[model samples]
Target chain A: MKGPRLTEIVAGLPAIVPFVGPETQERQRGRPFRARLGANENVFGPSPAAVEAMARAARDAWMYGDPECHDLRAAIASQHGVAPENVLVGEGIDGILGLAVRLVVAPGDPVVTSLGGYPTLNYHVAGHGGRLVQVPYRDDHEDPEALVAAAWEHGARLVYLANPDNPMGTWHDAATIGRMIAELPEDVLFLLDEAYVEFAPAGAVPAIDISDPRVLRLRTFSKAHGMAGARIGYALGAADVIAAFDRIRNHFGVSRIAQAGALAALGDRASLDRVVKEVAAARDAIARIARQNGLTPVPSATNFVAIDCGGDGDFARRVLAELIARDIFVRMPSVAPLDRCIRISCGRAEDLELLARALPDALAAARA
Target chain B: MKGPRLTEIVAGLPAIVPFVGPETQERQRGRPFRARLGANENVFGPSPAAVEAMARAARDAWMYGDPECHDLRAAIASQHGVAPENVLVGEGIDGILGLAVRLVVAPGDPVVTSLGGYPTLNYHVAGHGGRLVQVPYRDDHEDPEALVAAAWEHGARLVYLANPDNPMGTWHDAATIGRMIAELPEDVLFLLDEAYVEFAPAGAVPAIDISDPRVLRLRTFSKAHGMAGARIGYALGAADVIAAFDRIRNHFGVSRIAQAGALAALGDRASLDRVVKEVAAARDAIARIARQNGLTPVPSATNFVAIDCGGDGDFARRVLAELIARDIFVRMPSVAPLDRCIRISCGRAEDLELLARALPDALAAARA
Candidate 1:
């Protein structure tokens, strides 16, 4: 018997994840990875205060969390120097992206982004039937000027850009991004994803004008605060744009413990500072390992480093596979040129040591 | 300035929540709720093992949750004697409902349900631009025959039914629902939301056929498992129907801590049995309190009792307001006949005592 039909937009899409999760890989291998250097998760973990907060809040899991997310939003608003109405919090940045895309994009509308940018954003665009107009990265970086030009050419409603972008770990300073934002088309909403901004220099985040309806900036506790599994993120935009999320978001999406943990994590300044220092050290260690193995490490402004394999995308893919086979989890971009390098997240000493020892064997195997 | 244009359907809708949460009420009142007996949350709490599980998982908040939900799905399927492919877990039943509605009902598509059955389902339908063909309830119970007839008349693609219904706390025997499913329109899909069935009597949940694409059954860890704040739920359907969710769902929506807590809760059958017994006792106590206050308590199959005020809708609404004014959280249905009753959730002895002490004054004040 035939069941209910899917909407044309969703039906046309394939079931795919932006990145294959480490857990899925573990299942396939029938063993857990020794180092989870893929997915770019912070290995340093959340603030101890946050962990204690979640533990303390665990027993009250029977009651539904405040659907409004009032207190956390208030704290976030204060931190960003924006009113609470200018922000909307959701399950994660991924979830917030879905709402952002849905609010502005109609089926078949044009969206602009860099080729081989964050795949999750593209996934959201596809799910909403938004046609993505992709431009190639310039000099291993997302060229804001090229992106703005493409949006104008396509008459796109939305354009996505990540400061201190994923996979490549490259960034543009605040002044350059400000210039880019100024030149962007009036009708296009700039979806500024600052997921890795915490790892960048102080000038990397452009000054945000909350009243500018064309710019929507989203930040998360996931990257810098090291609470990816907690899945808490918020967006800052014009009040009208932010309020649009209420029309479709999961009202009770954020878990109660998550709220408590995030709130506590925000308050723990020492932990944030400590994590940043540790992440810098890990990045340096990964670079050293790359240099010792006769590879070039790309300069990075984020928690992960990209090491050039001195070969093509296919060669890099083999290296990634060999690394996985050696119980060292790593990833590479799906596009050409960029895929000549493998990406590795910052990890603790033990995890980094495992990667350091396994790299030579993985490289040799890949060459063979 | 008009920035990016909203998709036409989303632009036409108003921002709304299915129900105003208790926290929102507290925010308006400028105080904490004294007795949180409004939302039908299990006041007895989840198993200690579940709490411990969440606490332990809190330390590992750096890692993203398993996107496939492999282990949790395996557990749920094992419990129900279904294959893992037949089950799909999500943030909650509310989230799962949104996915279900999006999968089937396109813009302007007709959906069949009871007029005031579940506002959230209607909200989902509206969010997706689906029209609702709401059939009125028959004597405080969902009229399955009427719902099926409406679907057939409208040639609707989706039909929703909440077994051991909420707000009204009523149920239909398995055989009757089975008959209703048999008579449902050939191409129509039935969404069976058995959220409150754990508090229901034997034979209340109909036998589900996993191979039947026409019916998809959703259950939650919120009610019987007492983990609403955890935001965990699962849907059961034909493998293909279940797989359809992979196309659009937030891959890492569920938190790692939440997954651990739910898995532990599912394993604690003794705790579930205890909660069921306690809930029954609380229901009886609420009924007794209603009778003592010169109100008629409707017989209930779930964890709440609806008390008729022996007056019209406005009278019951006032009674609800007076309780809220006293910092006692109780909710009443919004529709006509249903609004003639004030619904109280099964709370602990202390919460119930607060309700008992406040009812007479609320009644008197509402009458005045």
Candidate 2:
């Protein structure tokens, strides 16, 4: 018997989740991980004020949240030094990426990104039937020059680049990024994912004209603000491009609790400063631990550090497997050069202690 | 020089929001509504257990929610006596609706629904470039027979029918709905949006096999569970249809706090029973209040009652405006015969008392 048919685009797509969450791993192993340092989640947690705000909002969860995300957008706009019309708040960076892709890419349209860059963005692109042209990273960092060249080659309408790039925690300074922005093809839309920018050094995020319609800046509270579970993120772009999201976004997608929590967290500069300093210490400790284990740790501009496993991708894979078996959750990149290193998130001392204890044994086991 | 181009379809569709929320109205008026009986929200609020669970989850908002939605989906499966694979949870009914449409609708594909049924349903169809074929309601209820016939005529891939219908608060019995289902063409997928099913009568929902690929059922915690702001909803469909959602859905779209709140809300059956009973009482009270004000209250199975304003659609519109001016936030349908009535949601005594006190004045102002 015939049933309703799936659109050819969706039918052609494979059902896959870009990231395998740590919880799924725990379920398979029948136990919790000893150190939850994967997924770049902040271990220190959101501010007490943010938590309190969420609790307060929980009592009033009967009414639907403001579809316009009024107060939250106003606050975000003020912080960004742009008009509220220039901002678009959504479920998270993931949701905003999906909408951005939907707005610009049609079937058979070309889209470009680094080969092993954020898989979620690639997923959104592929889900929309966009042809993906993946350029390999240069010098272990997402190469802006290569991305621009690929976009021009493919006549790509979209290109995704993350500042303080994931998996390898590398970054380009503001002046370097400014030159990249200036060099971008006028017809291409740059999807600038700055999800980890808060942890990067000052000026890693180049100042770009918000009125310029070519680039969309994506930022999330999930990283430095320590509220990943809340799924709060926003996009800053030209007012018209921002307005385009209104045409297709699930307007009430953000939970009221998330809105209130993000708003509160944004106001708590002290908490942000504390988390940044704590993350820095944790990063340094992680580097020292890597050196003690005879692995070279890559200098990081984000909350996570990538450690060169002193071997190939396969060897790094084995090391990751050993870590997982020992209940120390860590992840590595999905592609060649980047995959030669295993990435670990900055964690509290207790969590790092677990990681430290497990690493030597994990390394021995992987070698065997 | 051109800067980023929008795809033809997105560029072509009108940028519009399906509903103007009451918050927007409040902002425009520069004052809050004294009585918020609009939007069909359960003003009594979520259970204490749910609020507590959400508050607890707030502390752990640093980690992302499980992409699989494991425990929450299992809990929902247990409640429905279906396998977890049969259920797909999303941001809300609106979110689920959008995904469902995206899966089945290609550009210019035909979809059938009642005229002025659910604007959001139409919005999703339009967003996905689906051609909407609207059949007029049969005697103020969603005309399933007409919808099916239209689907067959249009060779529609999808049909949306909201049982315990919105705007009119009317529904067909199980036997009638079963006939509607039986008559559906094999190629047409029936989208049964049972958002208000909890408030519907015992036999209002027809028995349909869970294995049936011909239909998918949507439900929400927004109404009976009083968690609209939490944004929790689910769809039960054939395994394949449910599985298809995985290919394109935002895996981590639902927030962890929402997941916790929904799980706790589902376990609190006492709260559900209490709310159902309270809603029924409120419906009766609304009818009595309508009679007291010399208006006709339509028989309701849903949480809200539709009051016939004793004149035309324009009269009803004027009365609704007057109620708004008096700070009584109530809504009326947007289309012809349906617009001849104003809808009032279930509210606590204080809220309804505000409505009760304001109705006569609103009506008098309308007449004057």
Candidate 3:
């Protein structure tokens, strides 16, 4: 029954997935949900061109993708007016976060993130045997100042922040973020997850120099470009830091179809603009729905709204369970206080209608 | 200008990709190859059903794929006659190899593989700081007996063998492999890579015994299933060994579109059978062409044929270069003795015609 012993780090780790898929829940419930508004997926879908490109590339799936992600990186570079060396395209921001943690965090190394920020990042830190030092959120936003102070206090090797943050969907202005960047220890690497950046206001992303070497900015096709299923994302950083990925990454990990789809998605800025607008409108609709249900929806810069249920985590959990029971799929935060809010993604009008129908009943059921 | 220092292991490793992709080569040469018979890609492509499935899934690209890969695993398990709990699908066999190496190899741990076996596996071992103890191929095939000896001699944590191996298109029969497995150290994990198993002869795959904790079998949709670009592969092992992946894997790494395409691919056995027949014919055609050119084609048990170029490694390299120059993309091994052969994949009839026309000139160029 015994096999080769796993590395001490791996053996000590727990078998855990950061989030459970709605499909798994559906299987247990024995019925599919009418509204798929959880996971913050783009209900509007990817650009027509991207879809066509992936379809065409499907036949060529026999060939492995370019290990270097040449075409996609070239397109991203041209779009951002940076050298191709500045980018490292990976499976997704999630995958890149794992790789980044592997590169910098050795056993017992200190890493920092806001409490209840992104569990996946924390998951990676734990996987690598790093010691996680959490800075709690300020007003439901990742407190930049607290994170920097903790980095110095802990002599942390890495610090993570998600701009236009998930769960709470709050954001910090570019100037504030830049000042936070200025105060950070030069030895502490910053992971600026711009996963929701495209949906944020124009001035939200700091104009930091890529040559600074202290920061890695992660951008994904999952959000604005609506290619989450393609699993394509890139990190922008100093050339040396970027090149470090070549040493350890599964070189041919990115599939050929994903490369083609992401490249096409990057080229179609018009479609991205349209998605941003649609997401904004959907966010507004969700906020209104929350108000109608006697809950307060936190104003969102991202594609999802977090509705405070004005009670404990258990009440929010009940509301979420009731929503699911009524064929509406929604998620909530895992940690306390934040867990008092239920998270709903922006969806199509019909999907929102299903949510509207379910919300009041779910709230009443939870109250009962 | 400083960032967090990479861990001593990562900092000491070279920032290099094991293989330069064909696209990168094409970019460097400023022209695309006319016949891409390199990389052992299925030139005939995937099933129409799979293509259609991916096209349909493209519209749903906004959602993250089920992190568990539920449907695909169910389909694969049913096809393979194993429980879904015994299966662990990954980005590709390449990705799974990386994870396996990471699980077992700590700093300075010894691992064993053929001297010239899959470089990507070796790359993963080195990335995780595993000391690679290579046993050279005996004759043209990987010598399983030698590998077992190496494992015991080094007290290696893991041993890797590719049945119906890559680069050479050679194989060791199941009985031979099973006999060697019996002799392996009880505690040494065995990575049995069955990437080309579908193209292998009947009974080539050892009998499935999920209770054997020492062995993990890796199967890929990339090869025979023609979904390489979709990046789906699975590993089968004892429940405990299989479950270890959840401790460290990027949960949402696989794409929703990929999962859909792979599920469709698995359901269509007729398509797989057809591709197998085509692959056999293509292998025969390659062997015939090699004979006509006064070369010896190594006996193959896989989709590709390795043609002995009747010269040294340098001559084979020159021949490969000439074939690439003539737009008939082909590759050769990196090590001695094995490098005396040029590897060519099974392609469409038109592609073979191009190869036929180009081989003589390429041979002459190599001789010169």
Candidate 4:
């Protein structure tokens, strides 16, 4: 009755999920959320055109998707003014992160990232037996200097950074990032995650030449384009680095309906622009609400606002739990200093109103 | 500006795709196929109810799919009379194959499968640095005896077998397979892919005994339920084996629309029964047409028929090319002996008509 033993590394690993989805919590509570502002999902929704394209595609779901992802890749290449060979579309950035880790990391190879950064990437590195070297955040921002120094110290093959960072919603301007990129060791490949780039300020994202083989930039439709449920994302890199994906990727992993939906979503720039504007207004409203409640709202370059609890991590955790109990779903950071804040996403008017009403009572309960 | 070097194993790997989808071939020829019988897809199409479900879910594509795949897993578990912990929904059997390889295989690890078996599984094993030990088909069927011998000889950590097999459309009955399973080495895991099981004979599948944790059964909506483009599949195994998937799988990889479509497809047994009946008729039609063209069609347990070319691999390849040139899309096995046969999938009357008209000319050209 015994199963075959897993590989030594896999046996040592804990079966941990990076995030406990709200769905799981709802199932535990035996009820659905009245307001869902967690996970940074676009409650503003996808474009009407994209929805129509998906509906049209639904009837023809018998045939397998094009393994090459031809049309979608061509559209992405055109938008970026690059050759199609420079782009590799995957299930999502999360999927691509796994592939990237597989390509470069052998057992015990070193990888570097900010301590409180994207856990999914670190999960992939660990899955592949990579040794992770952590660098602590500085003043609520990813300390690029510390990350570069750690990479060099550990002889790390990979380093990950999110522009317009998550959890804290802070950012470093393009010039600052460019200077940090120059300091990265020649052998250390930079994985620049720009999941929130479309919502960042004009000068926040750098215009680095993608022909630099030392860097791979990841982008997703989940945030700005509002196709999170579609699971479409892409990586842009030098042609050689991008071509390596063909050596091991699940070529037919992206569904046909997803490709159709993402292509249509990309074409609807007006909808994207409108979402960006709405997100900005929502951020301002959230900040005002936080100030009225005597909480400090961190300066945000992304869709979500991180409200400083003006207390310790335990207080922030209690506030998050109280919000969940009130049927208002929100999240908080997982690590030390950053964990002292609660993150709220941009939601529809009704969802925001619910959050607004629930927060004061939730805060009071946490305080009590 | 060179990036970090890929591992020695990955650097030596060729850039090869396990299966070239029909869509890619159509793009290369700059014309669509008159009949898509190459990939064994269910040309009968998915249920209308499933299509409607997907269409309805399309508007809500802005929210990320529940990473837990809660509802679909619950439904599948209920259908199978098992707990939800025993089921893990994935992108497809292809995606699950990759995860299995990651969990069990390490560099230089031995893995066993039939020669010319599911190439995607082989691709994943090689991608993860496993040394593949292949056993040849016996009398046009996978020899479970040889597979077991090879596994023992090489101390293989895993072995893969497809029932109602692809390429050759052959199968071994439950008694024979159960005997093989009983004889298998205790530490060696068996991946029994039942992708086309619904189309198989009633007695072909063995009774489920999940107590034997060394066996993991994979099933898919891609074949019998006619949802290949939806990209939804599931794996059933012991709780420990199933739990391992959570440590590495892309949590939000399956799209919301796809999950909805697959769940609806699973619930519609009447549609599935009708499709099975239609598939049997189509298989018979394909065999009849092959006989009319002076070819010998292999007896099949699944949705496709393989016709022996009465010559070597070269003649079969020429015949396949001629079929493609005539806009009748078909495929053949990649290795020798089996390569002397061409595979054609079950399809509707109109699609079979295209095949019927094209086969004679292709055969004559091959003879010439």
Candidate 5:
């Protein structure tokens, strides 16, 4: 029997999820993880106010959400000091990345990103049939200069960079990013993913310039605001670029509960600050744990830490596997050199305690 | 500055929202509608258990939902007596529609749909650069035969049919749809949108046959389950067709709360039956109200009724405006013939009473 014909791009693409969720892992293992410190989810949870708002909004789930995301966009604009027209709210950073790719990267187009950077971003690029030009990381950090150079070399349509980078948890200062932006080709759209920017230190976040159409800044409530399950994120860009999303985006894709929860979460600055503080403390504790276990921890600006396992990629793999077997979930970077480190998200003290308890045994097993 | 370059398809299309949400209207009017009978939302609300499940899930919103939607898909599969591979849950029907369009529609591909059918479906077609061949409705129902003819005429890649049709609140029986499916070309995909099928008359829905590779049946919790704001929907089809969705779908786009709510909603058969009954009563009340206002009510097997205002599209539009002015939210079809009718969703008795009180004045104002 003949099947539905997929687009040439999609037909050629392999079916794979960028990251398997911990739930899937739990289901496979037939047991839940002791410490869910893998996905970089804010284990601190959303603000009590946001939780209350979402719970309350649950009763009103009969009504579809505002398609334009007006109020939430307005609030986000007010917070970011940009016009509402410059902001586009979507399902999540993942969803926004897909839209951004669709907007610019047609089939056979060239796109640039760090090697072993965000897999989901690459997934969107490949899903759109974009030929990806990968720039190897410099000292485990996304090398901005090399990215721009590759974009120019490849005549890339888009360049993706995650500030306070994922997996490595390293960051470039605002001035450094500004310099990179200045050096980029005018025609190449820069997708600046700042999903973990909430945990970045002061001066790490670049100033928002809505006039520059070349840059799209992505922010999500999933990290610092702790609403990952809500699947709400926003992109800040030039008015026209933001407006172009309406041509293709699912208008009501952002749910009422998500909007309400994100709005409430954004308003709760005290909760955000508290979570940041908690994340910082947890990061330090994770670093201390690494040191105590004879591993070196990478300095991090984000909520997660990458610990050098003092071994090769295969050893790191074994460590990861042993951790998973111990019911302690953690992920490591993909590819050589970088894959020698395991990434751990900030967790509550009890969660960290479980991780700390598992590390020695896991490391010993890897050594075996 | 050079802006982000859009895909040729997106660049050519105007940035227009398919539907102007009621919230947008509320913002413009600076007042909330007393009766919201537009959008075909179920005013009976979600099952209490579903609401409770969502409310409870809200607290755990820090972690992303399972990317594979494992448990929910299993539940849906068992409920439909299909394999989990046959079900693909997404953000909503809107989201699933977008993915479906992306899956099969390459630039310049031909697509067939009823004129004045779901605008969002047309929007997706346009977004994907699909050439839409619209078949005019026969009587008030979407002409299955005409659609198939048009598909053959245009060499269409996909044909869209909304069973228990929107706006006009019309439908065809199972046999007619089965015949339509049988007539479709082997190369053409059939996108059967059953968003309103839960409220469709008994025997109106065709039996699920996952063996049919060309047909995809879309279902949603947004209608009879009263979880529109949750933005959760699923598509059932041949395992391969369903699997193709993962090639481009935002894996974690379905929220945790949405999964919990939908799972719980599906389990509460008593609540669903109650909602279907209440909606039938509401439909009758709406028809009575239309008759009281000297208008004709179209026969409906869905949650909404289409009231023919004894006028043309222009007059119907004016009546719609007057209803808006009277704090009643109702919608009308976009094209001729169907445009002569104003569609009202099933609402509670009080909301219908408001509609009853407002209709006469709205009609008179339009006449003036």
Candidate 6:
């Protein structure tokens, strides 16, 4: 029988997964990692209140979640000092990115981003048949000027930048990003991914300007709120742009447990502050470990630190493999230059202790 | 400033939401409903084991869920006697349907469905710019022959049917549906939504045939498994067809709690059977109430029943409005003939008792 014919766009696209979860590796290795320090997940965990809310909501799982996500959006808006209409809650920033791309990008449209930035955004671009124009990083930081130049040159529909960038753990301060946004073509949408903003210093984040129709800022409970597994995130943008999400998004996509958990997570300021502090300490510990091993650690504003392996991408991969062999979970960037470093998420004390023990042996094995 | 330019397709698309959630109505009305039955959620609730699993997983919300959904898919496959590759887990049936439409329906592509069928599927097709060719339901049941005929007539890329249909709660036996499937065009992908299948009779569901490349059967934790708020569902299809989901789906869309909960729900057959029994009893009770109010209840295989209001669509609308004013949340079909009935989900005894009391007054209000 002739099967269903895939659309030209889908049929021509490569079967690519942006990131492989740590669980896949655990299954393949036939053992669990001693330290789960990959994926940049806040190992300090979600607020007690959030967990409590989720547990309580579980019994009510028989009801479909509010398709409008009214309360969650309202809470997010109030916190951000915006109207509820300005916020759109989704499964995560990843899901929201997909919808944003769908809203603006057509087949063959150009989308600009850092060369080795968040691959999930790139994956969404590819899925929608958008052409990517990648700007190489400058000194391990996403080059805002270069990205803006590319967006202008390509007449890009969407331009994405992760503040306090991933993998390299490098960031540009608010003024640089704000200037970049101003330089972009008026028609080009700027996606400001603040997934790590809560962990960054005050100067690192730009003040919210809801009046900018071309800019959409995405934040998530997945980071400092320590609720990555809950799969909830929100985008703050112009009301018109935010409302566009309802036109195409799966309305009931966000789970009821997630809505309740995120609302509670937002209300619990103590937990957020505590997780941020723990992450800061873990980052320092990771850097110290890197220095002891004769490696350089990138100054990070995010929860994860990138430790230069003092070698090339190949050598870093070897070190990563050796760490995996020793039941340590870690990751590295995929592009050149930055790929010389291995990225490790902030872990709990025991998790970092395991990493501390494994690093030297893994480095030795890689060198050998 | 021009701001971001939406794609021509998106710009041209209508701002249509498939369903207005009950939460939205509650907010507008300034009160909560006495009985929550509007969305066809299983009010008897999810399995206790499933709830327990979700609550336990709540603490682990720090980590991202498995993108491959290996364990859950393996379990689903094992139950259905198919390879793990044949099962694709997603956020929900609504989410999976969106991906399916994206895979097959390009701009201006034809899609076929019952006139008043699951509007969410229509929403997705519209979102993708697919041309919908809706065939009218015959005698309140989805006319399988007309749908198949429409596929042939329009050369449809996709065809959708909900077994034990929603809104009307009518169903076709396995043999009839199997024959309908056989008559479909070789290249037209068939989306058989058996969301409420657990409540269906023995012959209502066709035998699983995962080898069929064109048929993708959808099942959910939302109905008989009673985990609607968890937002987890699975699609069973040919391995190649199922694997195509990876090309465009939000890989991490499903929540970690939902995966664990659904896995536990699948394991707890006793709980599932018990829910089914309760649903059957509730269906009977709802039917008895309808009869007592001088209404004709449609024979239903799903967890909800559609009662003929003995009036036209306008009268049914008035009755629905009166019910809503009484703080009893219920919905009716949107298309004619079917719209002459009001749909009510099976609920707990107290919920039904409340509905029973409200019906006569609602009907009188409509009559007056």
On a 0 to 1 DockQ scale, where is model 3? Answer: 0.79
A62-105: candidate 3 lDDT, tens digit per residue: 88988888878988988888899999999999999999999999
**For model 5, what is the C-alpha lDDT against the true structure?**
0.92
lDDT of 4 at A73: 88
DockQ of each: 0.77, 0.79, 0.79, 0.79, 0.83, 0.83
Kindly report which residue stretches of model 1 are placed more than 4 angstroms away from their true locations once superposed.
A16-19, B16-18
At residue A210, give the lDDT of candidate 2.
Answer: 94
Per-residue alpha-carbon lDDT of candidate 5 for residues A188-306, written as tens digits (9 for 90 to 100): 78999999998898799989888999999999989999999999999999999998898888888899999999999988999999999999999999999999999999999888999
Chain B TM-score list for all models: 0.98, 0.98, 0.98, 0.98, 0.99, 0.99
- Per-candidate TM-scores read 0.99, 0.99, 0.98, 0.99, 0.99, 0.99
lDDT of each: 0.90, 0.91, 0.90, 0.90, 0.92, 0.93
Cα RMSD for candidates in order: 1.1, 1.1, 1.3, 1.1, 1.1, 1.0
lDDT for position A285 in model 5: 100
Tens digits of per-residue lDDT, candidate 4, B179-295, equal 889988898789999999999997889877777888899999899999898899999888888988888888878889889998899899999999999999999999999999889
What tens digits encode model 2's per-residue C-alpha lDDT throughout A15-84?
6555578999999999999899989999889999999999999999999989888999999999989999
Listed for each candidate, the true contacts retained, as a fraction, are: 0.84, 0.85, 0.87, 0.85, 0.91, 0.89
Q: Scoring model 2 with DockQ, what do you get?
A: 0.79
The true-versus-predicted C-alpha distance at residue A302 of model 6, in Å, is: 0.5
Give, for candidate 5 chain A, the lowest lDDT window spanning 10 residues: A14-23
TM-score of 3: 0.98
* lDDT of model 5, residue A368: 87
In model 3, how large is the Cα lDDT of residue A280? 96
Q: Stretches of candidate 5 above 4 Å error? A: A16-18
Model 4 chain B lDDT-worst window of ten: B15-24
Instruction: Please write out the lDDT profile of model 4 over residues A1-368, one tens digit for every residue.
Output: 66787998888777777668888889999999998899899988888988998888888889888888888889998998888888999988988999998888888999999988888888889888899998899999999889988988898889999998988899999998898888888876789999999999989988857778878989998898888888889998888889888889997888888888988988999999999999999999899889989999999999999999999999999999999999998998899999999999988778888988998999999999
